[model samples]
Target: MKALDTWERVLLTLIALVYLAFGLGIEGFLSPYALADSTYNFSEKALIALAMALLVVAGEIDLSIAATMALCSLAMGFAMKAGASLPLMLLAALATGLLCGALNGWLVTRWKLPAIVVTIGTLSLYRGLAQVVLGDQAITGYPQTLSTWGNGSLGDLIGVPALIVPIEFAVLVVAGLAVGLLLHRTLHGRRLYAIGSNPIASRFSGIAVDRYRMGLFLFAGVMAALAAVLLTGRIGSTRPNLAMGWELDAVTIVILGGVAIEGGRGSILGTVLAAVLLGSFTFALGMLNVSGIVMSMIVGGLLIVSMVLPRWLRLLQRGARPALRTV
Candidate 1:
């Protein structure tokens, strides 16, 4: 797989220091149970981030993923209302996501439209459809098994109740690893990077750029649906607003991981670590009773800073190199 770079190393150190500070300063932050429970804050978001990372690496963006997730959750809710079994409900959710993604892919790839524009339109379209279906009502009373899967803990470790990892979080880890290997260890991944770097050049080099982009969109849609499954199970309810504004978080995680906004440069390891870092930061603020709006402001500030600081650093490096050469 891809090796870590200086930026990733700095992020890793920052994460370690932040965790240590919280563990030492907060009364219960170091407890095994508390540590495991905090994963709930970001595991679903991280799952989407993993897929979003690939899309971004290929020089594309999808603003519709959060809406796609909402629509998928509504599909599940309707399926349950119709007395569909869990397996069937799950299938319905996945199919809905795939269909939505295919629409996005077609609009962008086949119609030769801008991905940002196409996805933005679908973002509103999907969410509007969801609101129309539910219309100010929430669906509740999901299957007990689903709730258990979402909220239940693995058996205790070392006699610590619920100290083991959460099933949702474990799934995120497994997915992260799989994506990491795919992005870093496979030839398909190199094509994505090539396409991201320069689509016309990649095309000339025989890289089926459009096809890869479509596949990434398809993968992103499916991952968003999977996130909907986990989130619906955890909350035991569904609403049209489910996962509202989550696309921001997913993009933030990708950008904060040092993925170039223009694409063709980033690592899966960085995205994974960045997710944990952001998750921990958010959880710590929540523990302090921070307001949701303020927490969002913080996230926005972080995103802005993450984007600007790297450019400034590179500029400084360029300046220093000139000075050293003159010496």
Candidate 2:
């Protein structure tokens, strides 16, 4: 408990420091509206990141999430073109997501295939399906309500620009809280940790490891679909390549949040903070006119650092223990 608390504090402090630096060093980063707008940069990705964190904690990875988002967005677009109502469109997106998730889960749990390999295969398959649906074209002219949900702010009610956050961002916050509670204060969470720590032992202990993994995959799919809705609303279009490479970003956020890639250790709070940190960093770079490729490089570098730093620190601590004993 004490160690987890300490790690959380460290993450919180790092977030604060990063924000402070960007606000002071970058032009327009301190502006109230700029900060609010930046939330849009990370909100959708963070939504999927939350689910990805859970899956990682259960000792699995899903590279298909971004592709799944594209597929869901394509489904929603098709439904809208068919004159479906807003609620119907949402249902279409959610259902599409659930089905995609179920497919991944089935392949892994039922077939007993490795999760990494299964998701990698599905990643290409889903994205290819999306391309087939859209076929070198884009879908536009979505309803106004969806646009409002994606891009609108609550400033109309709050009457304060600084306090006015995007509706999508607010939704992300609420979802984060719910997931945090589920992970830290629930029996299901304990089972996930157990499964990730040792699957054979977990099964011997009567844990339904395969069932729980399937559920996690399903959850991940649903969230990815939800993110697709928000993203399509914000952009008011669906393109086959939409959200391309976002899987890497989601994984980066999870790893940077201190979630063990091997599973069985992490927190939603840390994931949330890490999302904020990465979003803010990316936004700050954009303010400086950084290119997308440069941003990708930075993200890759951060991912490497995040993975290596903890292990390096642990080694130093281990070495210091022997010196202390000799003294």
lDDT of 2: 0.91
| Top lDDT hit | 2
What digit string (tens of lDDT, one per residue) describes model 2 on residues 1-327? 234344467677777887889878987787888989999989999999999999999999999999999999999999999999999999999999999999999999999999999999999999999998779999999999899888988764466665578988998999999999898899988888888889999999999899999999999999998999999999999999999999999999999888999999988998998899899889888888999999999999989987886567566666656554563
Residue 185 displacement (Å), model 1: 0.4
Off by over 4 Å in 1: 1-5, 156-163, 317-327
Q: How do the predictions measure up, each by TM-score?
A: 0.93, 0.94
Per-model lDDT: 0.89, 0.91
Regions of candidate 2 where Cα sits further than 4 Å from its true position: 1-5, 156-163, 318-327
Per-residue alpha-carbon lDDT of candidate 1 for residues 196-283, written as tens digits (9 for 90 to 100): 8999999999988889989999999899999999999999999999999999999999999888889998988889888899999889
